[model samples]
Target: MLLLQQSSWALYEPVPESYYVHQKNINSVTFEENTTTYLSGQWQYYPKQLLQTATPTRPSRTVLLPISFKEMGYPQNTYGTFIGHFKIPKEFIGRRIAIWIPNQYGAYRMYLNGDFLLRLGKVGKTIQTQQTENAPRFAYFIAESEYFTVTMQVSSFQSLHGGLENPMRIGVSQTVNRQFQQLMMSIAGVCGAVIGVGVFTILFAIFRGVRHSQSQGFFVFGIFIIFLALHNLFSAPYVYTVFTNIDWLWGTRLEYIFTYLSAFFFINYMFLLNQRYLHPAVFTIAVFVLSFNIVITFLSVPEVFEKLVFYSFLLGIIVVLNFAYGFYQTVNRHEPYSTINLWAVVLLCVTFLHDFLLSLNWIDSVNLSFASTSFYAFLIMVQQSKNYAYHSSRIEKLNNNLLCTRQIS
Candidate 1:
């Protein structure tokens, strides 16, 4: 009962209802303590124009919020402006309201009620004049009027067409901040759990001894878990919120590096496990392949991340191939824990494919590296249990033989 009482906050968290604009404005919205809203729908879009504090003129067209860079024929490598019209209950006049622009690609200047509130990245008319930033932005202001206008000037010169790719959030200050807090907390919680799995895996490997057949691979697998967690941390919104001034380039580099290491360590573990079936020549081939990708990453610019996206797909293929062979070996040898390996490989491959398509921008879903690792860890633990049983029986037999020989002597 006490546990349930403590968890009641989870149930009481502000629930957000999504709302879209119609006829260029959203009206009759009410702000409450326990609710927030997504500012979506159609907004006035002015192409190739960067407006200042003045009201936007007749829009050249309209684009929906949460639209992709290519959606609705939205052009790439262009500057633009968006105007959002919203009306709230009069009770909000004396209270504070906040707008949250979730982290995503692009850079912009934000204005509310004809006042400049945020300038995240340089918004310019040309590529030479723009600097792209992908991070969350927020502003709070006392509502002086029932109707408010939000104007944004955005530039998409150097990235996957930044613009307004994500929906902005609006609510009373507390509710909006609470939403951001929850997002960060969820991400941190997942990362922390993955790290715990990693530490336990390492400890288990040590307990089994360095001479154990699975120890090397199991230890490396633990390292992979740690790398995976770090990669997720850097890639998530949590890092952006903590390191507000972090360059997009440096953050991405760390993310990419960790991603590469995680894949490498996991693949290495696979090689170690299948040494009987895999030749040393294959290890050389794998190293050469990964080394090439690493070299290119270090030599290239930030744009390398997008251009080298093929690397992500290639990594996915390698990961799936390694797991497939393990599954085959397990089934062929009739390992007692083969069932666990089968399901682990299948689920890992599925998650890898999900992330694979997500990398290519073909799908939208949660990154499942942590889930995949957890599944693999479970399989590893089960296999270790089998090894312990086998080794214990052998030791017991040795003890019996020694005792009988001593008695005879």
Candidate 2:
């Protein structure tokens, strides 16, 4: 069983051995254990400015998981730490023990048995100096004693979300590593697919010279996908491999900036797709939104501008809804293929809104926006090809008619 106790900063003592062992069949052993059980209970939380003090005082109160710094009453840009101690079971001794963390919001240090085992990015006092390492990491230490302690000092000066948002687990090294590898592979494959499609569509438009509004629309959509993919990649922990030593402030700024760019191009793409509506104001709105995002990116660091991103996204929703409404009205006007565009735009807007809410901590839902967006993009690509063919056929017929008329004359 887990224990929750409040104390000023001090070393955690081993728990009494009389407690029952929660074990099951793991790794051919008669009893297996879930690593999460070890981390489930309350932890001692220290808010703001972790110092190198020899003995930090215990926390004043408790904070729960699935909570953010904003909700915790911490200012926009702040840092915090969480400390937890768990008993090493007699059975775990002599085994290569490892701990797996699902998600950590920012830079952090993981300590085992009072020894620093792993550091993700550089934890610092401010965003300017803080280097964020956002990656899944695990360290192996032979269980030498009957108890062990895990302390995490996590710092966040950029994101709206902060702290330990997911449960961690301790288990055999091989099992944990395998799980982490699988998760990384899945993310990599998805990112690869988006990049591939984005590149192909953009190249096709460029080489074809974008003769009509339909082709231009496709090109804009491609740009949106490319930037969206970049945003996802930069937001991942693995990005540290490529951009090692990146300042946390700049990294987050770029991530959200890419997001804004994607939104901008998406609106432009929608307008170009259905030209019969011919609304000039939509283009003006897209330009205004894009300019706003670009100005803010240069004006402030992430901690200050992060809130603006959310609000700007909220404002962008108005543009998205307007586009969808236009498409719906076009369908009423008996415009060809307008129904398909209407549904696609509606679905895309919903996905975008859901993800925005998820980022803001207003709601929790599995983010399937990327997958849905990809599906709709593919459909649009196919339809754009058809539109091009249709226009070509009409032009060819018109030329033939003109030639016959001149011959008769």
Question: Each candidate's lDDT (Cα)?
Answer: 0.67, 0.64
Candidate 2 residue-pair clash tally? 11
Error of 2 at 368 (Å): 3.4
lDDT of 2 by residue, 72-101 (tens): 787645676665545555787667766666
TM-score each candidate: 0.78, 0.74
Best by TM-score: 1
Query: How many Å off is the CA of 114 in candidate 2?
Result: 2.4
lDDT of 1 by residue, 1-409 (tens): 1111101010111112332323445545566876778777666777777775334354567667766556657666777777766777777776778777776666788777556777776888887787776666677777766766677888776665456666677788778877777776676677777788788888878997967877877788888878878877777453444534557666666767777777677667767767533445655566666666667766765565556656556645655665667567766888644456567757766876787676555776666766576657657667766877999999999999999999999
Model 1, stretches more than 4 Å misplaced?
A: 1-24, 27-31, 53-59, 89-91, 203-211, 243-245, 275-286, 311-315, 318-322, 325-335, 364-409
Residue-pair clashes per prediction, in order, are 1, 11
